[model samples]
Target: MQNNLPTRKIIHVDMDAFYASVAQMDNPELKGKAIAVGGAGARGVISAASYEARMFGVRSAMSGRLAIKLCPELIFVKTNFERYKEISKQIRNIFLDYTDLVEPLSLDEAYLDVTVNKIGMPSATLLAQTIRTRIYNEVGLTASAGISINKFIAKIASDYNKPNGQKTVNPEDVLQFLEELDIKKFYGVGKVTAEKMYQRGIFTGKDLKLKSLDYLNEHFGKSGYFYYQVVRGIHNSEVKPNRIRKSLAAERTFSENLSSEIFMLEKLEQIAEEVSKRLNKNKVAGKTITLKIKYSDFTLQTRSKTIPYFVSEKAIILETAKDLLYQDTLSNSVRLLGISLSNLNTDSKNTKTEEKKVINVQLKFEF
Candidate 1:
């Protein structure tokens, strides 16, 4: 395992149930109630759910109908993007006071590199506490923070305490903290990937670290290398302030599943048009066209074609999507359809170079 590694003070700040909290903050009646932010219509999906709602298994991206089935007392509230954006701006301003090297993952979450911050604070733990305190005092909403030597660990540490709390993983404790972490808790490992790891007997970081690099590659493909390196604490990605958008997409979930391809053509056309519109609005075009299919049983599959040139026209997008749709047989009745564009002209030219086998870093500072 790689012991010597570069260290930088990184903090991941995530607002606790941002959307649902905002609704509760704005409306007195919603306080301490099980609420989800979305429409209660047949085709509606929950954007966010309060902790109370979560106790009943209501979660974001879940259908509103299912959410109601899970919690009969769940209140559905309409989304207020204007209010969210306004509050986000306020929170961002607080981050700016400490560091300009802020990488926003979303409106509610961000990674802050405070190795060399504006306030010249020596302790990242103190910085996180102060930042969270200010956010609560000024914005009237609580946030959670995770502080560590790198962004990867910081992001995971932030979720340890949860809902208005903070966790700091000192450099000395980084390895042990990661080793003890559940495989599912690793940042990039989702439900599907976690299941795959479990099938391979990789239940934790310690189990993953025991595997050879070639063994991981053979089993997990490109991601296997990432798993091997991260288990050894070798993440070297710097906190980039101007994180570029890699892809753009639009999707729709139907109230009723459509079985035939003929019934899907119109939906595909609409989706393609939406994708084209978003690409144009972003002033970018992509060479890759991907069609995402989500079946009624919640199984998802994607088909993609990368052309020689980037195209943002709806006609071109729709034609490509049509080709992909006909390329495969229907797996099951489709409930959702989506179109996404990648390999965009705006993609970064810089590539990540491999880190050395071992490198020394100053890790004596306070976490």
Candidate 2:
């Protein structure tokens, strides 16, 4: 059974509007300007929208047309996923130096369990502070962090202070802090859910906690259990640094949509090369091959086929993706390509991919 137990020290690190921030870092002119990624023309979906654009109600996943309506001056740029991935690797390396418990939520955010670490640090709060400072100093970008006793609380804490800010919560003050927070701010509680809670007089953690477990479970099937412990500042989600490559996958968005078959094949070759590199790094292979295609209209579809045994070689992955690509007729222009690997073995391949795993983040803190 899972519980919302607290960690001795847990921290959440989230980048500030990650993609937009990266753009700002590379070009100073983009800073404080309304910016977005993708085309402003028809059928363009935003990959990221800057804070300046957000102020005008623009957002990621919003169509480029609507974003333009909100902020006419929005500057659209092409996606440079490889560059972002490289930066993510650099940041991950820095986190690993401090502790092995680093669980990446995505390319831009991660949870860490640093209760007992390499440096024998005495305070998790101090460690979280140092990590935030180091990322800014070393990476030349701003990051925000949240430190608390559990993943639930820590994740929320990190968001309270954004764009290079850090927040800490002491155990003794947990209830009071939670009581004052708007119920809508509770983890996983969105607008519609909050409205329901408000009608039921569930306006705060205290209100939420007052409901019987049976009642909450009755109303919210599985997620109710999540709410129970969170109100009390307890969570038990592990900071799993080592997740065996369940599915070997690689993805890249083009600088622009590929309109010609020659350009499409070139992009596929690049992606295949990347998949091959990951396979060699992981030292694992799979019989199953999957090809993911994203069209210029932002509609995505995938195709997959499995082969016998596992493989971790570059040549094999490319051959498989190449074979998969032409298996279907091409009608629409493509904007993104992805390859994945699964079913790996340690003994039959390179020894590099097999290693002990480290946790990324822990939950719960003294302050």
Best by lDDT: 1
Model 1: runs farther than 4 Å from truth? 1-3, 260-263, 349-364
Model 1 Cα lDDT, one tens digit per residue, 1-367: 2555778899999999999999999998999999999948887899999999999999999989899999999999999999999999999999999999999999999999998889989999999999999999999999999998888999999999999999998887878988988999999999999999999999999998889999999988999899988887778888888888899999988878999898899999999989999999989999999999999898999999999998999999999999999998988999999999999888864335445343345656777
Cα lDDT tens digits, model 2, 82-193, are 9899989988988888889899988999988778778878677888888878888998788889887667778888989887898887666667777777888887898888
TM-score of each: 0.91, 0.69
Best by TM-score: 1
**TM-score attained by model 1:** 0.91
Flag regions of model 2 displaced more than 4 Å: 1-6, 244-366
RMSD of 1: 2.9
* Deviation of model 2 at 70, angstroms: 0.7
Give the 10-residue window scoring lowest on summed lDDT in candidate 2: 357-366
Which pairs clash inside model 1?
A: none
